[model samples]
Target: RKARALLVASLLLHDFHLRFEQVRRAEVLALLRALGVPRVHEDFIFIIINFSCFEISFHPQSWVVTSLVIVI
Candidate 1:
């Protein structure tokens, strides 16, 4: 059980990092949209949302800090 838990935690952290990257990219596109830039690809938006949820589920606190730092 302990080993399983550790494995799960590691997977979660890996997923969180991937999602964090996606969200960061999406936010940048969003900023561009706000600035009258052409919209980004739909696939990009979909990937961002999907990865972001994975990150949120895996590590909410880390996601918050990481996302904020990336955004800024």
Candidate 2:
């Protein structure tokens, strides 16, 4: 449960270092590796990082994903 949340947070976050972390997400990453689910997670992590570096979603050249934590 917490692992999944960490995975979600990883994609939603920009910097790799987190502000409030009580649980190490590495455990979840290990589980994913053991369960063969790391591919999807790694891919998304790469996408998030790529977007963060480029500040744009240019792969498909269609969608422009915004920040997950948006101000209303």
Candidate 3:
């Protein structure tokens, strides 16, 4: 289940990156660096997706925790 969530997040990250402007792109990279996420790590992509506010769809319905987990 975690693998599936990571996969979806990865794809969403890719799609989001394509729409990012140069200034925002630089800012994201900087934020990642500040957070200690290495550029080469695959998890950085997932982190980007999460930070971008892309909702992850989970099964059993119970996995949905958007209402409780505040991003900021």
User: Per-residue alpha-carbon lDDT of model 1 for 1-72, expressed as tens digits?
Assistant: 231111112222232344444455556456546645455565655554554522343465334322211111
lDDT for model 2: 0.35
Give the clashing residue pairs of candidate 3, or none. none
lDDT, model 3, position 67? 19
lDDT of 3 by residue, 1-72 (tens): 232222222233322223222324455455456645545344544454456444434545222222111122
Ranked candidates (lDDT, high to low): 1, 3, 2
lDDT: worst 10-residue window of model 2: 63-72
**Pairwise lDDT winner, candidates 2 and 3:** 3
Q: Candidate 2 at residue 41, lDDT?
A: 49
Best by lDDT: 1
Give a tens-digit lDDT track for model 2, residues 1-72: 233322222343233233222213454255345644434445544444434522233334243332231111
Best by TM-score: 3
Range of the 10 consecutive residues with the lowest summed lDDT in candidate 3: 63-72
* Candidate 3, position 57, lDDT: 47
**Model 3: per-residue Cα lDDT at residue 66:** 27
lDDT of candidates 1 onward, in order: 0.40, 0.35, 0.37
**Poorest 10 consecutive residues of model 1 by lDDT?**
3-12
**Candidate 1, lDDT over the whole model:** 0.40
Residue 56 error for model 3, in Å?
A: 10
- TM-scores, each model vs. reference: 0.27, 0.24, 0.28
